[model samples]
Target chain A: MNPVLGRVFPGLEGRSLRAAAVVTVLGGLVGVIGGESVVLALVLALAGSLATLSLRGRPNPLAEEYGLLPAIAALGALAALATPSLLVGLLAGVAGLGLLLWNAESARDTVRTAEPVEGLLIPGLGLAIALLTALSLPTASAAVGAAAFAVVVALALVVWALQGALTADPYAAKAL
Target chain B: MSGGSADPGPLKFRPRAVALFGAAGALAVLALATHNAVPLFLALPLLLGPAAAATGAPRVPLSFRVTWSSEGSRGEVEITGRLTPSAAGPSAGVVPTFYRPEPLIDRAPPEVRSEAEGIAFRLHWSAPYPCLVSVARPMLHWRDPLGLVERPVRVEGDALRLQRFPPELARASRAPLRRTTPLPGEVRARQLGGAGEFFAIRPLAPSDTLRQVNWRATARAGRMLANDFRVERTGDLLIVLDLRPTSLGSEIDARLASVAAAGAYGLAQSFLDQKARVGLALYTDFVESIPLASGRRQRYRLLRALQAATPGETAGPSERLAVSLRRYFPPGVTTVLFSALADDESTLVLPHMRRRGFPAFVLSPSPVPLLGQLGPRPTEDDERALRLLRLVRRRRIAEAWSEAAVVEWDDYWSLSSLASFFARPAGRRAAS
Candidate 1:
């Protein structure tokens, strides 16, 4: 196996590889939608690969030296600004934000099991994308009047109360 | 079940969590700078991940129970944890801190899997030579679902200690015993009037049996007489480990100390099996000794002492061991000194013990094998230097041999030669 590939995939098994593959497909999808330069695709691929390799506990000097992650985000923002289609910009933004979180998760001393993180992160990213897309709708934002704002505030208060009520008691120690 | 309190410290954000928050803040700032809503929307995923993880992170009480058993050199460990819905629960990724990489050997990484009740893993470890190995209580690692944070929960229990001796040392049961204590045992002693090989005739005592009466002696003397025989009793053995630093350096001394500890364990185990009272003395900056006694519990005590044996920074005078031996162990008890005999000070230890009336033996682990294994000589002149060093080592062993029986143990894997040396009668003082 190539050293680079070994570091990126680590036995070519586990959730990290699957997650990297998904990130790659999302990057490719964004590239097709934006009709941007090949540089965007290359940047996305590099970021995804770096994120995957980080899980193998190898020191990554390249990511640090070039600030590759922030650069990718900046490029995505620029691509979104340049493209004419709103859909392209939405996908680009989503991809950039998703890649940043992925890279952040990979930066650890040991390979992490994906069972716990995948279930939460995948849905969280999807929910964030959906929320962003819904909020981006001009008609929906205009139609929502003072009544919607009051409703939103009421829901927020209810969530806050629930969060407080659900907090576990620190005194209740359990043994295995 | 054993349990410990979870750390009461504030929640520690993973580096990635910090990075997530930083990325969110960076993108939000970029959105403000560019006067565009798209960049702001792009930062949502980054902000949402850590927020979700933090809100959902387990604060509910959790507990873990870890147990292990030795299957040859490998330890099979099982971990069971009680988890609330708030926690990520137990998984294969959670590992104890005691799992460390061994030098010179590329061990197979431990594989953990979810079992019916908990999780199980295998840890492969061994002492390449004879030595005592200790496993300390390890900290259990736990991570949140998003891998955004982690907590290290310490496992509470007694640490495991084991002694790995060379397989050849098991034959030490047949080792010759010259001195015996007052306790009755299998080995013959110098004293007469017991059920063993006949010695001479003596006037018949009330305790003398009809079979022990010597008719010829009785007829010649015209008086009642009985056959006397050598008594069978147990012996006292004191194993002393020389932990003083050597000229070879700390690294090599550590290797030598491991081999010596193993050798000491082998001798102690064999002697203890033969019903001999076995004690241990570790001579470092000061003499640390376990008093001589015979039983299963004494074996455990000696092993625990050996587990802590390591090479020391400074060397105590050879006479210190002799003085300690007189204070703790009985006089004329056969004392075996495990030393490399690398320096003249070590060479003098056996003689000092002998002067103090301990029948001393030196099981010197030769450092010659370690030299070859460490690496090749760095320069052409280095080879000559090593040769001169070998000559000096030989001279030291020779000096020690004059004082007591010295067995130069060059092999680390087996102790057949040492066992054979022990098998020979102790009256014949020779070197191998």
Candidate 2:
């Protein structure tokens, strides 16, 4: 397994493929809320898997190499806000976290994978979008969607944390 | 042996080395200021490439094992580590180093080398003293990319410990004899004559009984042959170990304990070699009582007694050595005592054994030289002090064993000294 970040989430190519599939699912779901849902879905889907790959260990791969990762995630956050409605943004956000656990039961080899940080960041970006859209519109649907998004992300966060704590840590010993 | 390099790998940045980065920054500044794109292009990647590569370097798992091999005081060890197979990214490695406080005189730690089969190496070591092989933690040399910085990553794994036990005498070169007991055994006795293991058959004498004649010989060319046999006597012996504290470091103290163990193991070994029944008992702190019996198991009894002979709290007076001997041991059974003879109680053991009617031999380890070897160096003043110390030590030893045959084992604790000591006129009579 990859030493720090990759140790938590290992299958890169498969996860990447899943991320694409998740984007299609997310896009169709968000389309119900209308207004740039396609773009929002794609961003959230990619960000969720990325967070799954990176966020688990200390300075997951994206955050470790350079400031490059934070920059990309921030850009995706900007894209999430462009969605027309808070409902669309919230749906995209919650979907990313839920999808991180979608196939999590079949723990994959983390050697070439990213960190698990994506689980938090994608939802965090969604949250940012929900706040922006909620403030701009102040509609009951926006408030309800924001509340639902917050609840889902909070639950996902707890489960992700508990999972990290429970995982059996296998150590490597080298001759000195 | 893997070559040891003091050069710190490129994980930490030194001022002199950091000057290159400073130089790169300066060139970039100079290029823009002088309107030249050449230096900027070159310096830009120089600044970014390593940081990028270090980030992307594949992280791999490494595992290791520490194994021990030994024969008496000398042996070798194998320490090997393997990286789990991976095709994810570029190769990386771990270099581990074992740590210790005191320098090993002739022993070297395993050299670390990363190989396809994994990193492994072997090292030979010789330490004849009793010790805990080691308790120090190991560390690994971790380097980032481009040999620019090196860091120490403390390696935490299941501890590897090779218990260093005192040397056990391997040869029964000298056999100590004991007085005859009722049990039938292998010790030959001069006074006791009976039907025994066949010694020889002679021509039938006129007075020879018909039952004593060998029928086969009578039937053959020989007219008659009287069967003759040597009386086989059983002897019982007990080895007493002193368990009082010693004034020395653990290593030397262990050596002293080992010396005591050597005496006990050797004596029991020698007697067992003669097929005489032997038992072992401890004092200062009372250990279990083992009854006398002749067989292969007696060796095991002696060894277990030696292990019990570890240094502990000072208990009964040295005279108890005799009291204990008298209480448990049978009359006429010879008692061999291994003690430092440094204390008042110990000083009385020899006379006690003699007075109790048990043939006694005392093997007391001389402490002065061993003290000098393990403790502080001896100067003229130190020598004078030692001489004073020696007078007291020897006086006490002499006081207890004044009328008894005592062998004061000195600097080189070996079997030859023991053999020769026992073969001396006094020791020979004591054995008989």
Task: List iRMS for all predictions.
Answer: 7.1, 18.5
Candidate 2 segments exceeding 4 Å error: A1-176, B1-68, B72-106, B111-173, B186-234, B246-255, B273-275, B285-287, B294-298, B374-378
Instruction: Say which candidate scores most in TM-score.
Output: 1
By DockQ, the best candidate is: 1
lDDT of each: 0.60, 0.49
Question: What lDDT tens digits, residue by residue, belong to model 1 across residues B277-357?
Answer: 788889997888899887789988887787667899998888888888898877877677788888777777776787887
For candidate 2, the chain B TM-score comes to 0.56
Q: Model 1 chain A: which ten-residue window has the lowest total lDDT?
A: A1-10
lDDT, residue B181, model 2: 59
The positional error of residue A95 in candidate 1, measured at the CA in angstroms, is 2.3
**DockQ by candidate, in order:** 0.21, 0.01
RMSD of each: 8.9, 19.2
Query: Which regions of candidate 1 fall more than 4 Å away from where they truly are?
Result: A1-18, A21-36, A40-85, A93-118, A121-176, B1-11, B73-98, B101-106, B152-158, B178-232, B374-392, B426-432
lDDT of 1 by residue, A18-78 (tens): 5455556655555555565667665665565555445333445344322335444544455
Per-residue alpha-carbon lDDT of candidate 2 for residues B1-432, written as tens digits (9 for 90 to 100) = 122222222345423124335544665575556543233322332333233223322233222333323333422223333332232222343444444322122254334445554334333344343333332434544433232333543344454444342223333323345554544554563322226677777888887777778899777845777777655553667777766665554555556776676567666665576667788777655545677876787677666567556676656654566667767778677777777776665666566667776656777776666665534555787777777878888777667656566777664334455566656776667655
Clash totals, every prediction: 1, 29
The TM-score of candidate 1 is: 0.73
